[model samples]
Target: MIAGRMALGILVALEVAAGCRRGPAPAEPVKVIVTKNGWEPWKIPARKGEKLVLLVTRTTDETCATELVIPEAGVNVPLPLGKEVRIELTPERTGPLRFSCAMKMFQGVIEVR
Candidate 1:
């Protein structure tokens, strides 16, 4: 009886350890909204060397899509009318990078720290 009880306890411990190892890791994707004036929540914070994805939607037709610019990355993406665009960025350093619309009327910043 004593040996049987010990074996049962070991099996329960092993099951609990296996369950913990199979759990998923936590990862939350950041989201931002683009508006006629500029990027809603324009200032965003990201860790250096981390990958970030930006979903840019044109709320108005006044701003040309081609005008969107990220000088630091040399990325110029055009925004189509009434459409959502995705931009991916990886911060190589800790600093603020500027992103603006073609006419330079709409602007925002991405802060990597």
Candidate 2:
């Protein structure tokens, strides 16, 4: 009975420790719609180190889809039309990150604060 109690105590202690330990909280994904004209939100504000998941959905039937050109990150992603694309952005610095379409006519900015 004593050994069983000790084992139970150890298990309880381990459970408590495991509860106290926490991994990174799940990141909140941001949903943004993309149109032929431009991005739904011309400017989006985000905090540094915060995970930014952009759910870009194409809204136009035109051959144009939102293309993100992040010079800072050196990432270029082409968002297809009639479809959704997930883009993760973890800004290391606080500044404005520009994004545009292939034609460069449509543009948006991601402001990292």
Candidate 3:
């Protein structure tokens, strides 16, 4: 029973840490994991006009999310398989900015505050 309690505590701690991975919490640059399954943490948080460093890593070759597009910023960057694509942008206004693949099949959003 004691061992189980210890394990539960550890699991809870880990879960809390994972929950805070993004959302203006960490000092590190924002990162998104791209895979055949789709974008992990699809919603990104940012403040308008504040520079954001976005690091996107494509972990699979079969995924159709091969490109990242931000129409307002005039960005259409490609993500090569097994590579990380770094993008920098400053949200010009408060609203949802959509980013998706070239095919428009997979999509995500940046919530500018």
Q: Whose lDDT is greatest here?
A: 3
Error of 3 at 16 (Å): 34
Question: Against the hidden reference, what TM-scores do the models get?
Answer: 0.66, 0.69, 0.73
What local lDDT score does residue 58 receive in model 2, on the 0 to 100 scale? 80
Ranking by TM-score: 3, 2, 1
- lDDT by residue (tens digit), candidate 2, 1-113: 55643432211111122235355763676778876567888798876766566777887766465576654455567767767777775676677877777666777888888
- Report residue 96 deviation for candidate 2 (angstroms): 0.9
Q: Which candidate is the best by TM-score?
A: 3
The lDDT of each candidate is 0.60, 0.64, 0.71
For candidate 3, the per-residue lDDT at 85 reads: 76
Q: Write the number of the candidate with greater TM-score, choosing between 2 and 3.
A: 3
lDDT, candidate 1, residue 65?
Answer: 38
Cα lDDT tens digits for candidate 1, 1-37: 4564343221111112222433343224456555656
What residue pairs are clashing in model 3? none
